[model samples]
Target: MAVPRRVVIVGAGLAGASAAGALRERGFDGEILLFGRERHRPYELPALSKEILLGNADEPAWVHDENAYADRDIRLHSATAVERVSLAGHSVLDSEGEEHRYDRLLLATGSHPRALRVPGSDLRGLHLLRTLDDSLALRTALRQAERVVVVGAGWIGCEVAAAARSHGAATTVVDPLPLPLRGSLGDEMGEVFRAVHAEQGVDWRLATAVAGFTGEDQLTGVVLTDGTEIPADMAVVGVGAAPRLGLAEQAGLILTNEVPGGGVAVDSTLRTSDPDVFAAGDIAAPDHPVHGRIRVEHWANAKDQGAHVAGNLLDAGQPYRAEPYFFTDQYELGMEYRGLADPRHDELVVRGDLGAREFIAFWLREGRVQAAMNVNWWDDGDALQALVDRHAEVDARQLRSGDLASLVP
Candidate 1:
């Protein structure tokens, strides 16, 4: 394939920004146009839930300084939404009605928070954390809130609850799962998070569904499915997120449905059905060699996949095989998880003390490690990743008490 003279990227999030940088780094002297719906330059999303919500930082953690793009000759259009895409003509129409053509197109459109569509969902004082503005608004409300109810016990929900509790509000987390992070960590590991939050004074309403919100204008209370009403002045809904697939759908690209999370389907090269177009970040559901067709929404996936696709855009022909990785910080506990594993079916093994909340937890199927997480046990990330990459059988006893380095071979 001949090298493209121009590249257009939609979504100015981490993925798009990373791809732009990688292209320049790889000595691609082509015109790069990056469009972002948000007004701010590209920034990381992880800190919004932790540092920003906790009132530790006000500004976003920018991926690059304001002049970085101009310095690299990358044209960035902020607060400009791409309304439509013409695959046949190889052009995109922005919200401003300006049509721009491209030799190659990338859709890193990312995802948006799934709205809570129950009764009273439109009430005031109810919020969703996604953008920098959302985090700032939620933080402001948290400071004034006396009672806070967070719906969903996932990463965002848990982080928001911790932030609210830290601000001296009465915080409660509601979820249908039996425990926090049960879907990701399984019951055995989920129990550890339950203890961590319990110690931080976070109330759990597990195994229950949200019936709806009960309030006149401002959120006054959260009504559960069991007919219990938890009084609250503010509520945050963090059920999950869905990919921004409108452009992909409009362009008639293939998309996956409910198999490995659901998003625009891409092959091993991160190339969409249309060879001239590619997808990355939260929207790209790559047919991974090891994990099958999975869509990872974590920070690591966005950062790595963006660069990976840049290489493929230059005809690298290399398959994306990076292990899925993510981290979380709630209250005083911090954890990093590497690889993917189904907690329900995989056998879990621990290398440190669970009571102390400082250990490495490994999820193994048969005798090979599928995933590994370190809770407050730092400095072993590479070793843990090696264990997962090796995919070799190991003694359970050795995994629990043996040296991590010796087990890889």
Candidate 2:
């Protein structure tokens, strides 16, 4: 057995960090170099929009401390961004024209904020919350502003709107869609979130589109297509993120498309089209045995995929399959979900109380569990997931009976 000399991982986010740690844990003693574009170390990303936005988190604790990385023998390269990967030569070029060779390379470049094309988007007060710097800028704006307008009623949009409201900012969310989160949770449960935010004092503008900006220098307000003007001290865009795949493409790596949310396609083992290079985190789009090929941007997915990549790197024979999972916190509500629940599902069964602000909605297709949402009642998350995983034809009556133990076969 030939021992590999070096392992290079790009993007020191959750995926890269986990891969490094898992490599050492799995007994890979060769040179392990972790490259991160950001000066800060890899840390958890979920808190940026929720706790960190509310001014309750210390940004320094985002990643593992230097001492911890030292103990793990994980060579940390901070403030260095990989410009390109030379797959044939097995080396990656940094921004400063430096090169680092690797026996195997992992591209975890992740995703970038998707900026809107509407005019006034370049204003100083217009911000997007994806990185620590973005979070800092948005938090400063949230504290200084009395009125805030959030465009795009998606996860980040809703979570930031809730955070702004918590900071005493008069917040209004504008979405062209009929309701928030209709793309993922469907209209049946979107109503529950609408009422939740409404009760928390967030003004909602459904089916409304932004025409342009109002201020000359900074963003003071937004002009809607309906000719309604709403005051805003700052505008935070949370539409979504675009995968950073420029490096992969430049390396002549075969790209995979046709996945939901636009991500690079990889195999079940998390290996990209180039077998020598693997991808994880928000960028790697793997074919789900059940849900087909999908690109997922979730904390749980990163961790699972990272471990899977490590196993495959050690021995190519190992099989890697990831079950996607993610959670969100908004206005005293904790919502968690697992698996792929398509947006086009025709039947949705609601278990528990939607009015009481606590319930689980199961998305089914052909009597199979496609996806599910659990709000404030995570105790039954496993049961619901089981029912979905097994493709069990759950009796609506038995599901709402408050007893899930019987449903688990």
Highest lDDT, which number? Answer: 1
Best by TM-score: 1
lDDT of 1: 0.92
Q: Candidate 2, TM-score vs. the true structure?
A: 0.95
Model 2: runs farther than 4 Å from truth?
A: 1-3, 60-63
> Backbone clashes in each candidate structure, one number apiece?
0, 0
TM-scores of the candidates in the order shown = 0.98, 0.95
* Model 2 agreement with the true structure over 181-245: per-residue lDDT tens digits: 99988887888889899999999999988888778898888999999999888998888888898
- CA lDDT of each prediction against the hidden true structure: 0.92, 0.83
Model 1 segments more than 4 A misplaced: 258-261
How many residue pairs in model 2 have overlapping backbones? 0
Q: What is the lDDT, from 0 to 100, of the residue 287 in candidate 2?
A: 71
What does the lDDT read for residue 278 in candidate 1?
96
